[model samples]
Target: MSVDPVEQWSGVLDRFEADIALAVSGGEPVPWNPPVEAEAGPLPEELADRARRILDAQLESMAMLGKVRNDALAHLDALSAVPDSQSSAGPLFLDVQG
Candidate 1:
């Protein structure tokens, strides 16, 4: 079976993102980083445009992730509201008078 081009591209981008994040977080050294050079070019205008697009895409992805998390949490809360016999035990009583 052949891999989808979009899936392949996404894997590459995910690796690039992880490497950048690691360098930024100090898990990897910044000085010898290769991504910096990969992004650098003599054409500043084109690079700037590409950077803006990448940032916009990343922001959208984050927003979608947040929405998914919120939806999942709301579902969990709704389920939690329904009391289960295993979870509904009587209040604790201490035998301090014994």
Candidate 2:
């Protein structure tokens, strides 16, 4: 099925927002804590790298969302300025006065 561009973009923004929330939560659902010094292995570089990427994605998503929101608001305002057919064209029949 074809998806509207705006709607598709909106979904992307939503996903990014969710990702940001999860990242901000410090990977609570999954164990995110770095391995302790006594641990045999060092912290996973992949985790740190993934976190950075997520942060970048979150920033980009926020910027896109802001632009899209502003554009939508502007479009709405412009649309509101146009008079409806009834208001612009008046009544079809004239009123007969006594």
TM-score per prediction, in order, is: 0.45, 0.45
Candidate 2 clash pair list:
none
**Tens-digit per-residue lDDT, 1-98, candidate 1:** 75544454444455556655664444743353333433332334424554465567667656766787799999999998887756668645568899
Off by over 4 Å in 2: 1-46, 88-98
**Among all windows of ten consecutive residues in candidate 2, which has the lowest summed lDDT?**
34-43
lDDT of each: 0.57, 0.59
lDDT (Cα, 0-100) at 16 in candidate 2? 52
Candidate 2 C-alpha lDDT tens digits along 1-98: 65444444444445555666765554444444432345323324434555466668878766776887799999999999987877766776677994
Deviation (Å) of 23 in candidate 2:
15
Pairs with steric clashes in candidate 1: none
